[model samples]
Target: MKQLFSPRADRLLRGFGIIGAAALVLAATVGFALSRSDGTWGVGTPAAQPIPFSHAIHAGQIGLDCRYCHAGVEQAADAGMPTAETCLGCHSQVWNVSAQFAPLQTALALGRPVTWSSVHRLPEHVRFQHAAHIGAGVTCAQCHGPVETMARTVKTETQSMGWCLDCHREATPQSASLVAASHAQFGVEVPPLANCSTCHR
Candidate 1:
């Protein structure tokens, strides 16, 4: 019985242990490499507007603030689109009858809301507050890209949970100036946080 149990069994066990460790190392290496990719992120396709409005003209040349159109981005969960009146306030005289603005004209005459689609749509499971980001001094450019420069807006940031958390982790006192600017601009506190409930329901 003593002879039956030998050093060979110990050697065999050690060999199996080495093989298992190697497999784990290989798997982890591959997984980490794959994680670096932007898997399942949106193609960032530009949503077709009912009317082709130039953000460049409004926000760039004209110097209209983001809050001018998205009136609620700094104070609410949903960044509300500008009302029909808000649009017509300027367009009623600016480009009142341009072919490009025909859709807007139709919406006005119909007395209906302009059906503008979202550029960066989040998942229903995820509850994002535009106020939090806006308060935290996150610029529209940070998430929406250089919308002021875009003729047709497209997705710029991944808006992924990991990406959001990364920002939270990096928030420091050095960036306090931005938060102050945002607060001054929006009249809301821009606290940097990485709390789970910040986004998730």
Candidate 2:
């Protein structure tokens, strides 16, 4: 006995194979692209700050708390800029004797705020709350990228949504049994998981 095969069946099988291969290739490409993006997730690099400040000298050597300069980190939604008074606290006695402090002195004397450029600014539409992050146990180093070691601070992290969400998701707890495991992976207390309002507002 002779058996006959349908041409339609052969075409359908070939089509399905081609589609499967294409899907697999697309998925692999996406994964590879994500890995190569370098913590920015292909959005862009962090902004550069003005005045080439040294967190190493301040935070590391001098042992100033992050709150000294960023006074609002604990009290307000936005971490307030160091006022001229704050600068004068040190510049008055230290830089006051140095020619390098001339510009700072001039600004302080004029009662004008130092126009230091923001380094970690998100887009205008996105709002970040410093107090919330600090209250949630997010360390300054996690986002600021080891500021204590940076002499002239540079943009370290990409600060993209994916980066934020990845952190949040990893910290969320599922079951009480896994609480210790989750805390070990994340922290003792996780910040509110990356909700749209958390950053978008």
| Top candidate (TM-score) | 1
Worst 10 residues of 1 by lDDT: 177-186
lDDT of 2 by residue, 1-201 (tens): 453557888788889999999999999999888775665442234345434467789999999988888888886877878776776686678775667656676667798777777666678988777766676677887887777877876667777777778886666534343343333213444444544544565
**TM-score: model 1 vs. ground truth:** 0.65
In model 1, what are the clashing residue pairs, if there are any?
135-190
Q: Looking at model 2, which ten-residue stretch has the lowest summed lDDT?
A: 177-186
TM-scores vs. true structure, each candidate? 0.65, 0.63
The Cα error of candidate 2 at residue 41, in Å, is 8.4
Whole-model Cα lDDT of every candidate shown, in order = 0.73, 0.69
For candidate 2, give the lDDT: 0.69
lDDT score, candidate 2, position 121? 68
Candidate 1 wrong stretches, greater than 4 Å: 1-40, 94-96, 172-192
Winner by lDDT: 1
